[model samples]
Target: MRIETLGINHSAQEFLAEQNITKLYPPQADAVKAGLLEGQNILVAAPTASGKTLIAMLAMMEFLSTKQGKIVYLTPLRALASEKFSEFKKMEKLDFGRRIKAAISTGDFDSVDKESENADIVVLTNEKMDSLIRHGAEWVDKIGLVIADEVHLIGDKDRGPTLEVVLTKLKELPAKPQIVGLSATITNSNELAEWLGCKLVSSDWRPVPLAEGVFDGGTILWNNGDSDEIESSIRGPPIDLCLDTIKKGGQSLVFAETRTRSASLAAKGSDAVFKFLSDSEKKYLEEISQKILDNNEHTDLIKTLSSLLKKGVGFHHAGLNQNCREIVETEFRNGKIKLLASTPTLAAGVNLPARRVIISSIVRYDVKAGANKPISILEYKQLCGRAGRPQYDKFGEAIIVGNANSSDLTEYYINGTPEPIESQLADDKALRIHILSHIVSNPGIKGEEILGFFQKTLAGLQIRKNTLSFSIEIAKKFLLRENLIVQKAERFAATEFGKKVSMLYIDPITAIYFKRGLEAVSENNAHTFGFLHLVSSCEEFFPKFSLRNKDYETLSTLIENKSSELIEPISEYDCNRSLLALHSWISESSEIHLSDNLGIESGDMHRMVETADWLVYCLYELAKLAERADLLEELSTLRKRISYGIKQELVELVQIRGIGRVRARKLYDHGIRTVSDLQQIPVNKLAEIDKIGPTIADNIKSQLKKVR
Candidate 1:
């Protein structure tokens, strides 16, 4: 079917043709026929890469052609938001004659971009949009359409509540924007469509066909009862499958359960990958491998990844830095890398697809359960959906390694339906945070209104109304006890501190934790490790460093020595280790050094620092609220020190934009210690310092001038 037949604008059709996307896939056609172009609400639940994005683009263009209001495209991940932002920004280049401004916002939850407020279309992560709504951005009232990508993540435990509450709140807005939810096929999509008040278009149609099967020994028993014999050239099942796929002229994707396993499998499969690579390919991969190494800190993981990339294999996980992940993804998309092993993070929304996907393990470690649990059928389907890329392969192959439980695997995964997405909004922590946000956003909200708001949620629809009401009451009671909220008669209002807490995007519990820590701190009690422990103990800065046996011994000794100054007696090893890690970081330890000494990945350290910095800022904000002048000065210093990973003396010097820890140390060593010294130093002399280029020197001078 032609894209023009879907009632898209002439310019949009021309743009599609320019990109060689003149024809609509079956799912796109179905969506169009379901009134997607007429500004009607739609739930498009289809396979991955089945023109779902094009469907969204068509709807956006239709809305833009007739409406004056803005369109908000919400994605689940920051990476996906960025990718979609690039795709949507191209619409501005089309000959549509109108200035369709596009903007993207991510990471920062406290502020909304002014450009996005005035944009014709804005792409943002769901959390960013939720934050905007909480802060009561004026432009949200002008929104006429909202496109929620990966709407099925409404079942995710950590992020689902945010997306669900955001959707429910958007629908309840007075503007009543039309919503277009794109999702992978889920079992209860009909119920979801009913909840969203949208017409459903659920289809299994794909741009490229997918063949799913179970591999046991050397044979693949396909879903259709057909069998294929592929002997293993390698010992491991994952490597053998990868080798077989590469021999068939197809790139492979291996999905392991854990980050460790992903790297291990990739390393084990590197030799087999080398056998398949040509000399030219090997040379090109070596260059790419060197680029990866150059872009990252020289850690053991990076060394392993760099070596494996030379053989056309690489491991990808959240542990890798953003630059390394991007390099691997880009190279794989360009067909430079043959096999990539990754955790399920790659299966979520990233557009890196492969010709064949091998599921090395069906089970994942559940931290809360403290055991390995089988992944849901929905997760399995998501991994399988990455098998084929459109316009690249005739068909995709998704093979699950079978074992003694092969029959059950074939029944439950190969032929099974995806599980229904359930609402996780009823979680206590999620409810507490969002409840504060809702009240702070609208201060006059009464208890009844709060109940009504939650009643409109998916969780309210799934569970009993009284159950949700009880949970809301519990959150309200907790907030009142914490003094974050004050109740008068039937109306609930956020206290001044509570309003700031919501605005700062920190959890109410985290705010309470900071308040307690601040109350415990005095001139004699205040210590660096004490404050670090308080920040690490908060729920917002969780999944802290896991304590090894040696770490427990070290932290135990430290805790015994500092028990009087510590916020709480160190009972949890994880919390103590987190403090130790932060201490090392602020003590000017390099990321590579931290990874080697503390067993913390560079990426994890970066995450910890980012979270700790925000929490310290929160502590400073609380100190000011409490009018603790002495504590304020101390926390302000701590915030800067943690933010830059610098010493007390270098804090002021690192305040300049171009001067980080290393540059600050260099400037101090060169007798250019303070801003006054920086003002007296020549730009050329400053540039001559180690790691400081002329551009940075100029930037430092420019920044100093502005400060003066």
Candidate 2:
């Protein structure tokens, strides 16, 4: 079907199609033809960049034109949300038979300006959506359609709970907006469809036929038409095999097992391609090269990325600061990047179209095994799904490039079926906090009232109503028995202490620990960091040493030595593992193989870092829960430090608008510091600082007036 056939299809679709997408894939056509006009739920499962987003936008535009409501496009990643926001803003017109506003609300610190209430369309992340609902964002009522782009993220443990709860909450919304779930092809689309209570529309037809292959040594082994047996047939050289694919003129995405490893490969691979650029490009590249001497991670990343740029290559991993990652991704998507070395998280849900995807290493490190294990079937499929861009490549090539053991990669890719999406609705701290909020909010509303709410959850939908009712009753009893809430006769209101607990946004168990600390411990570093680390490591924390798990002794010795490497452990569910992994990964170089001892892999260690990041954020929020405005301000400043890992003006802008740590430090260095600096410096000089907008500048000046 012609993309133009959709009555509300924007010119952007035309622009995208003009670039390559002239026709819709069968699944996309099926979606448009499925009478989506009636506002029904539709699940679309196809390869990445296979016009799924176009289909979503078409459906959204149609709803906006014909229906009297708003559209909410939800993404798993804030970056993706921002990208799509920019993409959709290019539309010429959007009429909802009324005032139409289009905006992005991922609820980042910058999203303070977002006005979701008036938007005809709002692009945001699932977490932002959850926050809006939790905070009672009033505009949620106008929502008419919701597109869960990358709905498959429902399996993500850290984030999946929020998405599931958000969707369940949406289902309970009085309006019950239409649901559109988009994902790459997975093994269990039918089950996901049922879970979502939507009609299943699954297809594997890529606009580009994806050719499977394996590169052994220097030879590129073509798919002999038997994808089923390719694993056994091909054995190749290590990194060189993938280089062969790139030399053949096909841009390749190489999925590495670890971030440091990805950076290492991109550094080498890019140098191989660096001489291809013009002199001006080379000069710009040289600037990036020189900048790596700076202490900033972003600078180091740019240096790493410059190698890719010289050779049309890029590397992406969570460890790269957000700003650097965005630069690499944007450049790569523009086809300026011929090769991208990335970690598996990229496979989770970022839509960067690639001509071919090479599984450079199938052995991903597992933290538990403390060694490189084969990648999961589900993850391999997700990575391979990136192989073809529906509009660009005539046929996408997915090659598992390896040394002589290429058979392992082939075996996994060929026979690998995507894993079943597991329900991670475990006894999570986040979930506990949410449940408590529900109880407190409804007040006096008990048993069936609360059970009704739970039943609407993905867990409730998957389980029987009676089972949920029983579970809710048990949870309620557990809460009361534990004093998370108190019931009096026929009414219930959170006790004054309970209200404070809710305000703190912590799990009841964590709150109990805090209360215990308040009684038994002084306000000191050992008390604070120890309790924080313990709470953060709720998933697992080995007992403090008895010979088994000898790493415990290392952890203790480091703690005892007051090692500068140990920062304040963030208080969150995953912080413990994260801190340990980070210390291990970054600690003194060791020949003593961690794989043999801890059985943890580098990828698993990387994941711990990511999880620790989120934990740090949660801890920051907890620290901010206090009513002390000064302390909260300090906490915000520290958060900025974490976000940028620098004392730059941008970090300062985030810390406290109009002035950031850099400018503040400059003032400090100059012996002209604090709010008093603004009182002393010329307004123009203040404005010279990064991210200091006019409003902020004016505010700073006003603040100085009060200080004076």
Candidate 3:
């Protein structure tokens, strides 16, 4: 179907033409036929690279042409939000119907975001949207259309419940904005569509067809009845496949079950991938390799990743920092890096696709189950969905490295139907969090009203009503026991503290922990480690490492030595690894020290630091509310030190923007220890300091001048 014939307005059509999108994919055509442009709700379940995003844009432009509000595009990840935000920026040039403006809000900060309310389209992460609803943003009612990319994530155990609740809230909004859900193919599309009130536009269409297969020893038996063989390298089949893809002038994406495994696979493939790199690519990779090393802390992990990039290989996981992840993604997208190893982060809507995808394992370790679980067909399909990239390959290939016989592999993964999308809203933690949020947002919501809110949730529709009601009662009891809500005359109202906790977007349980810890410190003596440990021990800690056998003695020694100073009694879920890591971090330990001593990857350390920084701020808020005024200065100092990974002495100096730990320490050594100290130096003199260039020096002085 020609884009011009869709009657979506001339400006949108011309913009599509400018991008050479003259015709629609068949799935997109079906979506249009389902009255997508007429503002009806839709659920588009199709393969990757199948024009789902284009369909969402069509709905947005069509709705905005006649409506008077914003389009909220929600994603499941920060990177995906950024990707969609960048893509939506092009629509700003569409001047045919109404002028388009787009803004992105994905920060894990609390704000009403009044400025973003004016945008025609606002892109956000699910958590950010939920936070906005809690903060009661004025533009809540102004949303006219919602585009939920990766809508299938409603089945994800960790993120699914939040997305489910957010969608339910949007549906219950007075504006009654239309919803457009895009998902990879799932078996139970009817269930999801029914919950969303959607016209299910499901298909197997892809711009680049995919061939699913399995790799055994030296043979790749494609489900299309095509077999390919390679002389296997001692480094194993993953490396051989990397070489084979490179020989065909295509790239390979190797999916491992763990971060350490991904890194190990990349390292194993590095030597083989090196010989295929041309002189020019090698030189470019070497250049950026050094930039990566210079730009990040020179840890052994960074050095290993940097060295691998020189060999035209890269690995990605949550353990790598955002800057490093961006480098790998950008270079991979540009085809500079031929072989990429990653965990399933790609399956969460990252746009980094490859000509071929190699699944390094058919099973992943489940920590809770204490066993390795087979990959669900939905997960397998998601990993395979990245095999194709439009306009680059005639078709994409997905190969699984498995011990299963060819037929078994084909039956299980290649021809298997994906699992159904089920609601995770009944989870105790999810229920506890959302139930509090509902009462806080609705203020004076009754017990029945809270149950009513659950009825509107996906769980309410699918799970047994009695079962769902039981979960709600338990969640309400938790909220009441934590003192986050109070019963008054058969209705519930969030106490002032409860309202603050909800607005801060923290778990109700975490708030209780913070309050208890603050009262403990107020009545006793504690050090920075204890305070840091208190924040790290919260329920909000993510990307946290388990306390391994090796970690036991080290953490036990610390706990034994600091038992008097510690606020919360240590427990298994208290997260000893985070306590030690962040304690070491605020003491100015190097990244290598963290990795060597704590077994933490630099990426995970940074993530832990980010999580701790936010929780510490949450601690500060709770302390203020609890009237522990003395702890405020300590918390303020602790927050800055954790954020910059610096010490108390450098905390004041680090307050000056653009001056991180190293620079702050440098200035400290030069007798510049605070903003007041910075005022005494000239820009040129400060510029003479190592690593502080003229621009940064000027920035420092300009900041001090503004403060003055």
Which pairs of residues collide in candidate 1?
Answer: none
Task: State which candidate, 2 or 3, has the greater TM-score.
Answer: 3
Poorly placed runs, candidate 2 (over 4 Å): 3-22, 95-99, 108-114, 215-238, 275-308, 368-371, 402-412, 426-431, 461-478, 488-508, 518-658, 681-708
TM-score of candidate 2 relative to the true fold:
0.76
lDDT by residue for model 3 (1-708), tens: 888789877777787888898988899999999999888999999988888889988898888777788899999888888889899998888785556788999876667676577788899999999999988888888888999989899999989999999999998889899999999888998889998999999999888988888888689998878898877878888778877988889999999899888999999999888888899999999998999998887878889899999999999998788889999999999999999999987666578889899998889888789999998999899898889778789989899986857689888889898888889889998888888888988887778888888898889889998899898888888788778898888799888888889888888888887787777774546556777777776668876667777777777777778777676577444556777888788888998898888877778887787888888888888888988887888888888888888888998887788998999989999988878778988889999999798999999888888898
lDDT of 1 by residue, 1-708 (tens): 787666667887888888998777888888888988888899999999888998889888888877789899999998899899989999897656677899998876778778898798999899899989988899999999999999999999998999999999888888899999999999999989999989999999987899999888788889988998887664588778888888888899999998999999998888877998889999999998899778777989889899999999998998887888889999999898999999998999579899999999898888889999999999999999999877689999999998867778999998998899999999999999889999998788899999888888888889898889999999999999989999999899999989889988887878887888787776655567788888887788954756777787777777787777675555645464678788888888887887888888777777788888888887877888888887777778888888888878999898788788888998899998789999998999989989898999999899888988
Ranking by lDDT: 1, 3, 2
TM-score of every model versus the real structure = 0.96, 0.76, 0.96
Ranking according to TM-score, highest score first: 1, 3, 2
Off by over 4 Å in 1: 524-526, 557-565, 568-576, 693-695, 702-708
lDDT of 2: 0.61
User: What's model 2's lDDT at 141?
Assistant: 75
Model 3 misplacement above 4 A: 96-99, 523-526, 548-553, 556-564, 568-575, 682-684
How many clashes show up per model?
0, 20, 1
Greater-TM-score candidate between 1 and 2: 1
The lDDT of model 1 is 0.87
The CA lDDT at 570 in model 2 is: 27
Model 2: lDDT of residue 409: 55
lDDT of 1 at 142: 91
